[model samples]
Target: MTIAEQYEYWQDVRKGLSRRSVLRAGVFGAAAVAAGPMLLGRPAYADTPGSAVVPFGRHLAFGNDPATQMRVGWQVPSAVANPVLRVGTSPTDLSQTVQAEIRNLRSDYGTGAPLEQYYGHAALDKLSPDTTYYYAVGHEGLEAASGPVNSFTTGPAGSGSGLKPFTFTAMGDQGASAQAALENAQITAQNPVFHLLAGDICYADPNGQGKLTDSYNPAVWDGYLKQIEPVAQSVPWMVATGNHDMEAWYSPNGYGGHAKRLDLPTNGPANCPSVYAFTYGNVAVLSLDANDVSYEIPANKDYSGGAQTSWLERTLADLRAKPTIDFIIVFFHHCAYAVTTSHVSDGGVREKWAPLFDKYNVDLVINGHNHMYERTDPIRGGKPTRTAGVGDTVSPVTDGTTYIVAGGGGASLYSLPSNGPESYAGNVKDASGVAAGYFGAGGKVTEAVDWSRVRYRGHNLLAVDVKPAAPGGTATLTVRGISVEGAKAGTEIDRITITRTASTVDTPAFGSGALLTGAALAAGAGYAGYAAWRKHRSGLDVPAS
Candidate 1:
């Protein structure tokens, strides 16, 4: 469509969707004019009011703390006047109001197709812990439909507060597709407290590589957000960075678009804002940026200047030292130990970060990149500490970390090398089966390891039930893999139990030095330096999927 036609349609949208907000938007004329045309802002009569645009992609995230703070985010087709949020203890009386921050992101990929979108963000502060609150979005004369007044409950206040039980779901590679919508419905059915997107969130970049030759269509993000709103509108939808998320057309590192679309926590490392941590009840969750160290896709390798790894070590130490935090769940985009035929395990991940997980005795390490559901036995030092299977319970402090690859979040399915059904302890028809060789460390190793406990070629997501224990009780984490499509839709493909002492400190089987010894630390440091030097010399520019 021509520019004039586009403007006319947007104006028609305003007239048909919200007449009151448009009539009241004359006051914003001077402000829009002051913002200049590059931001796509204009005088009252020329621009469509944000309130009239009908906000879509409503989602939530934590504001540093999950108990008393929340960050509400949404998208608008155009700018509006003082976008605000009204929230309160009950939906009927949303008397408390807070002004929302507007991020005006304009996309022009040198293809003569320019698109502008306004993202609204609001951080709710000083909320009561363990309390449920209802909220609505819009500004001045406009308001979201009152029928669906969304509500969310805060987590427990502090550590060891006898927190109530909660459930959270996770998945990855959720591009806009019908299969993804089914998984989303299944996720909403679970009514989880929060959710995690491992990575490759929306394939707007298409290439899935951080390269300059990739084609980008920022409008695709609009559809992606609307698709996930069924569940994300209420649950805190936390996300990580994947290789497909990079947009080189925006900046040198190609994350300029990511920074605008999602308002993540700024409390992570100085170089990597996407990598952050937050605690809910007895669990401490950490989100990482695997693109910086992913070997399979080195398009944007070592982008974080080694600061991410250093910060991770310190964060793990701090969480493990706290007695209130029982479980440490680290999630990223790349697989540390996956046995899938497509995009096998990433060796750089294991070489750099797996040892840190072992040192802190992390309970669970979740990943997404393989596009399937797979689990590994409790592993330590490149080997399985115990053979875990269905109906089996394992202790992280005694055995090792459990790695789970739940990449089937709305994307196409990938099969194992064997092209067989899932392999469980009870259903292991052959012990000599080799699913696939791991990639990383400069070569592929064809070692037939038995750590592959369960592998299912289906679209699935992980639902983790965290049952907090009392002062002297046993706390347990129950994980269930739910299939979202095919004949096994809604069936549990895999389940496992992780038990920990309620109020005791965890004693890592491997001492601190045993994992990241002086020699290993030196090697890691040397590798980081070498990566930075190579990046500077190569001057490579690539886009993320």
Candidate 2:
């Protein structure tokens, strides 16, 4: 089935499942499923040369410093003896050995299928910055041959110093599918130094709202990791949490499963893996858990007790204050500004965080959850600024932050309203000036937004190139939306260049010039051009608190 149809099907199935699905314990209830023979004991794999336990789901992540700290994660089917990773500069000589920590997760609380999963992780520290290292993972009896050792080079240390140019990929809502695999391969082709999954990474949970009744399968995560291993094993795969990530059976906030499977930077709040920040080259990448303040998905709202928001304030301030960090890119799940009907813009995000983005002059805000590719013009104070549209360059310092809904990361494709043709080439803006539906403020709003820059209904991802400014020169960030599937695969559907000067922050007056009048907006003139597409306000149900 198509992704949109699949989403609707899952929505219906979740409704049916919710009627009977009840959590016996929180997300950390590993005991919810009685320990079976496999759960309590290790499985014996034949010791033959090829019979050794095969390691799958090999992926990479980084600590606060990408140059010095690296994290290698993998999975084994069952308990293994002395799981560990060996690394060195040469593939033949793995001189350094680090023991792996196994985190086991048992899933049987609500879903009929009960199973146990083991995630192995190893953290390599004190490494040289900007150096390449080869690595292999295995235990006593079973090891993948040393002939093809996986390897990744560390990024340059900190920001500010003259560093080589670098690129990174960003997307969200990547589930297990051939389309997702295609996107993965295309991303690897881009040769990005790191990749950011804004959120909704691997939709293992059928009911994506993170509600108590959602059904989650822990095994799907295994498939997802293996699915992306081709690229993830080489590039640093950074992830944020989405509504679907909240597995209700695992822990109170439904992130127990995530805690067990992945190891992220510890710079943020105590146990929130979904929220953190890291800087590489000239850019500071910040990942946020939109579920904490998602109007689109309120299941885990405020799960961080205001700490995440408070922390974001401090982090944004620091990034803005740092001389080396020329650009700040914040990524999360729900869109702060989107022009789709399926899951439109989230007002809660705008209410709580958009101001901070404006306050700090954030360069870009990337998000997912809409299952399509879309972008907004430079925005501040809840509307589009003078600078917006394709090929139109704007400095966030004077205009505002540009928001991208790069949700087309291999889930189903969501279509734009029938009011305008899909944007591409020179057709950057909606021809009919239709006010796309936006989900926020505990309801939906149809506003004729001049900020709708590029909207494409396709499966794609965003690759950003960060070029640090030289002394007395300006820095530039180039963002590309690449089509990864269907007839238009490999086409550059959207592109934008943002320039920044050496000055850290530049504040400008709000609502500068020819702004959409409040009267025209209130009279719904924004919806006039496409009256056929303007449906009455519906499907804006306030989620159960």
Candidate 3:
């Protein structure tokens, strides 16, 4: 069938139409199913009845509030009875039991039996701030506490001087490869509080065009999850949707699969599952759904009807207005400024959200799509504000937004310009080695200027160390690109420091006039008091792990 015909058939399937009705409409026939398994959902591995229902793909994600809430998600081979999660301060004493919410997904592309997968999510709310919690997942036949236990540390108090330093890792286009597995181990060694998967997760849909003709294997998610479970089970594996994530058969918007498989924050505009915001320490991170605004792959473009962008601008403004949030980092799939030969940049992202990023002085923008590690010089108003070389310090408040394409997350590397001198940590290239590439609508327009700074074509992930400072001090985020391949595996190939004032609010005077000092001290004391009150209201303290 043609792409349009296949799309129509998938649409019918998405609408819950009966197979007879679909046949009556001549959407497909037995010949189509007989053509190949690619057109039909492949058979899932059989799990004998009475066998163990081991949970795999166990991952964690923060709720709207990272300080006191967490969502644990996992997958089982087949449907299980009474699936639940148990949490406690110690691995041996998981006393708090919560029933898991099961989301079952079925994919039937052709005439074969539909592929069925079961996912479970348990929300752990009102957790104590900065405390470690150990948890396990199980069903009726399995013992939750007896199973493998994973622990995660909650974020520090969201407000007041209690803010603590933290580390996080990010990368995209991570498929289930040996390189990806190696990267996961590298990420675990960083001891990040969370990990941002910029998108193209698992590449279940190889075509990634959101067309029915795209080859998809729902089981890829199974292996992919198990691959990252070592790290994801502890660190929040925050994810953004990429073009490959759009599975048309699942839902009208092609996110039903994701909705069922992953439990993400729902604080963004309604129906946009992947767009949300969370804060840890002094930095606020926004995860955007780039598929909604991707011009290169217009399959799911404008799916949110501008609501996503509107919410994004509002969220950015709100985050920027908060004195506690010193840095705002936005991450999505398609790149706004990349100079790769493949899928260089998305005009839609630049057109829709780049200005808002600049308007809010977004400290850093991380993207994935082109399968390589590329960073741009600090940019503002569609031009490079300054050339930010590797190991250089950049203040987004003054320099501009620094964009990094950390797509080398376990996926095969894409080609960098062979003729040009690519710059990276330990190697800085001058403008004399300018390379030409095309980027824009459909990534077809050719324009070759120089904003691409560091380019490394290897399996790598970003390790970011965030330091919180007092009201009048400077907070810093040190980003390092750690390669996962070759002799320099686990070595830093790129590094940049982003710094900003700790807060917009002024520090209280210590010993001024009696009246002025009294007022200032009272105000400072009131803020701290409020923070303590809020913490008390959230939950009682749990012993640190």
Candidate 4:
């Protein structure tokens, strides 16, 4: 069928009407009559060879325990009988079979017909740490081992001598475009243990305001998943939530579709699926839902009733107390400290979570929504502590937290404020006075600042190499911002090293009025309390999935 005819047919389906009804009403002329048989039940594309259900958009995610558990998720064109996953250490020797869970989603938000999608997830548990496993998805008619196979390496063991070096990539605002495809290829070349997508996964909802009036096309997700499947099938594509991800048709919170598509850790709050925590080796990663704390887009702000924030604080405290955890990284959608022209900064995120991050001494915070790559100097108490030029090293324990705006994953680039010469690594353009804004009530509040260190208006992604250290030693995280621009493609736009003591006892820089009881301190204190507590407590090294 023609594109116009297919669109009309889907519209009729979405409206609970069939093409036959539209034909009887004489809506179409000769073209509708020519495509009537194909539009009656299924589209022409649905007829595959042997009528076998083909799966696409295959992706992988880590469960609560990255060391021993992994979740594989994929989408099928149609519902198939007994979807299953086959796994083994060798592709030739497929030995394990796991049942898959189906999550079918239906949406009828636009004028077109309602759309229904089928997704399958299989949770593999009790796997060995640091092992490479091959897996494939299939159903009854199609043998699982007969399909194209992919492999993923489980994370290193959490404690003891098992701590090892690893690499991970992060980016956000990645839509299905050539730039996005380039960044994905770059990430695959890095061979990261996992990829942290800071939200804005796909531009399914172009108008990111969480409104019913926004153009919503669920098909965009299909192309996006297919585009990223080459990399995501091997590397766990860990994701957070962005404003564009808030589709009003999904659910009350607009994350029901996310829950159906991505199989993230459920250790967060009861209702908030986007907010979760996971740990790999010495690094603890927390994914937050920025829409709940965004002032600029208040459509879904404060929807979690403070539960997400409370969980974040508790999770931070817990991770900080573990001697095995050397770094704590938080990633979300809105920027807490960025100087881009599009969406400068989110005051709600700063007001709500900055203090908590300060108290816990978060190592690094990654954000998107600005559509550019901007980094800040080490910040504490809402101000830059020191100048962190590219290639410079900063100690998070003393200097403060570093914020990176890596919104250059895909989509159209947003221009940086034309205050000074274009600044980046190696070539520095120091801006004496840079005008910026913080989004809040009554729109943005313009201001001036000097913390906008490195700004690159192009497509980029963050490749971080983490080197673990023995107890009482020092660990380092080497962060590199790789540019995907035309001529400067694969060049480094920014680089920094975050060094911290591996397993030392350090006191948190608690803000004023932050009181902690003895029990609370014992439960949520630094490594000192955990070291003392470890003498009496012993259990599984990794959390259960």
lDDT of each: 0.75, 0.74, 0.79, 0.80
* lDDT by residue for model 3 (1-545), tens: 32334556655654567888677546456554332222233435445442477889999999998999999999988887788999999888999999997777776645667667888899989999899999999987788888888899988885535677778999999999787888877897898999999999999988888866567888899999999898899999999999888876655677778888998887999988999999887889999998888778888878888999988877775564455677889999999988777787788988999998876678899999989888888999988888778789997866789999999887777887655455677776655335554345645776666788888878788999998887557688999988887787888898999987565343211233122222222234334432332223223231221
Question: How many residue pairs collide in each prediction?
Answer: 9, 5, 0, 4
Mark the 10 consecutive residues where model 3 has the least summed lDDT. Answer: 507-516
CA deviation > 4 Å runs, candidate 4: 1-51, 109-113, 504-519, 522-545
Tell me which of candidates 1 and 4 scores higher on lDDT.
4
What's the CA error at residue 237 for candidate 3, in Å? 0.2
**What are the per-model C-alpha RMSD values against the true structure?**
12.3, 11.6, 8.4, 8.4
For all predicted structures, in order, the TM-scores are: 0.82, 0.82, 0.86, 0.85
- Give the candidate number with the greatest TM-score: 3
For candidate 1, the TM-score is 0.82
Give the least accurate 10-residue stretch of model 1, judged by summed lDDT.
536-545
TM-score-best of 3 and 4: 3
Best by lDDT: 4
lDDT by residue (248-306, candidate 1, tens digit) is 54444556667778877777897576899999999999999998787787766777778
Clashing pairs in 2: 27-249, 27-250, 27-251, 28-250, 28-251
Error of 2 at 160 (Å): 4.4
Q: Write the per-residue lDDT of candidate 4 for residues 410-429, one digit (tens) a residue.
A: 98988877794468986788
